[model samples]
Target chain A: MAKILVVDDSNFQRNQILRAIKDDGYEIFTAENGKIGFDLFEEHSPDCILTDLNMPELDGLGLLKLIREKNTDVPVIVLSSDTQELTAEKCKNLGATDFMNKPFKKDQLKAVLEKVFQ
Target chain B: MILTPDQEDAIKEFINIGAGHAAGALSELTESHVKLSIPAIKVVKLADLEKEDDSFTKEISSSVRINFKGFTDGTAALVFPPASALKLVSLVSDEEFGTPDMDSVQAGILTEIGNIILNHILGAIGNIFQQHLEYNVANYVEGEIIKLIEPDDSTPDLVIMIIDTQFNLKDLEITGDVVIFFKLGSLTKFVEAVENVLS
Candidate 1:
């Protein structure tokens, strides 16, 4: 089972994604903010990371940097509601595996993961 | 860094662009032909919050806040008084209703407004300043404005740029405010950007 780390400040958003993929048999670990998300990532070493862009203490970009320090190839997907191309571009330059806008469909997640695994 | 006269004018003009664009966007979204415009903008400490602002913040029942990070980082919040909140939801959703309340359903409806308003406002800022800021999902809460945007203990006092806007939705004279709280050092950076653009 592939393990996924989910990081976001909003519980509603976190639950929405988790519900979408919980039955896929992927083990999921969740964190409220980037600081704890990074700690959980270090502890769990999830196969991939799904994170929100903005948070207190440390943001998703900061967490992405921390992840890339030790593991360069982990698929980090940013799930954001912000439609700013600049933010998506920033994620790509920072080595993110994918960027999915909010209110995404189940098929969208599945497709991204399939590509990531392939 | 204290703002020079040129810096102040530039910032004001920058906000004018952002707010004007946002108002147009709002009109398009609601299909109500509403004219939303900012009548005044100010830089103030929380201690000096205007009386109407103080009362409005206290009376408002719902708010959506988005955090942004760039040359400056802070939260931009659009808080609506209960009457105005109800009006906004009805207008945006095109649902006829009376006595609006913040249930799970209505909150979802208002979140749409928040997303559009905040994103367009930020988009305008990003376009003008040539700064790409990372913004988060709108954090929605039902409470007083101050309680919802609780100050972290580390930064108890806030330096805010308040954009006081008049949103004339049909006959209802509702007001919404975009309160931007810039982080410690970012205020200086933002002013410098304004000065640079003017120069």
Candidate 2:
């Protein structure tokens, strides 16, 4: 199983993603915010990273930039509930592998993960 | 800025119905009983929001805030104490809680849950008003307090609803607010709609 890192400020959101991926048998790691997420990224070097866009401390965009600066190849997905089109486009420009809107469906998440892992 | 008595009553009724829909959505998703209470609804000037010293974060061990916009110009925040959030994760994942990565997974789940509940509530509002409303995808954030205000330089009156409730799955207590900011023109329509409904 590939190792995965999930980062978001909310414990509830992080847990939901963890539960979805755990059945896949992947080694999972989590962080509460961008700063912690960045720290864990260095610690685990996970196969994939899923993060929220708006967070206290450091936001997803900032974390993505930091991760990109360190390593460009790892898949990073931007997950957010923000409806503004500009934000989604900005995430892509920043080198995010993909983007998913909040309140994502189980199948939708699984599909994205499968694509990333593939 | 003035709402007739009938208009106020209609707005309250509409919000209550929307809250019920949100509770139902949560129940279906978690397969648990959801209890929601509508404590009050207030319309405040954007400037006045700063005066309300509400600390949902201090009361809860940990909290999650998700925001959605588009169909309605507002934010729907879901705040869960740390213990409550963890318990929810455990129930959904069916994994013994040993601190499995908190950032990615929990944020994802909370984002989705927030999206569903917010959508349900907003969708209910749309239905009541006979208007089609679409929402931006939901996202998760953490803080002591999460507020949705009109952008700087834009002064718009907003309707704020405080909802206190608990989810049956592990008895997680969630308290949050749904904020809707109406444009000057839409405000008129809203008042008219409320009047029509109540009349």
Query: Pick by DockQ: which candidate is best?
Result: 1
State the lDDT of candidate 2 residue by residue for B120-197, as single tens digits.
Answer: 565566667665554444555555443333354246355444444445534756555554555445556666666665
Model 1 spans > 4 angstroms off: A1-85, A88-118, B1-5, B50-54, B153-156
lDDT of 1 by residue, A1-118 (tens): 8999999876656776787888888899999889999999879889989998767678899999998988568899998655566778889999998998654667788788778767
True contacts kept of each: 0.23, 0.12
Per-model root-mean-square deviation over C-alphas: 6.3, 8.6
Clashing pairs in 1: none
**Alpha-carbon local distance difference test for all models:** 0.75, 0.65
Q: What is the lDDT of residue B198 in candidate 2?
A: 63
Docking band of candidate 1: incorrect
Q: What is the lDDT of residue B145 in candidate 2?
A: 42
Model 2 residue B14 lDDT?
74
Question: What value does the lDDT take at residue B9 in candidate 2?
Answer: 63
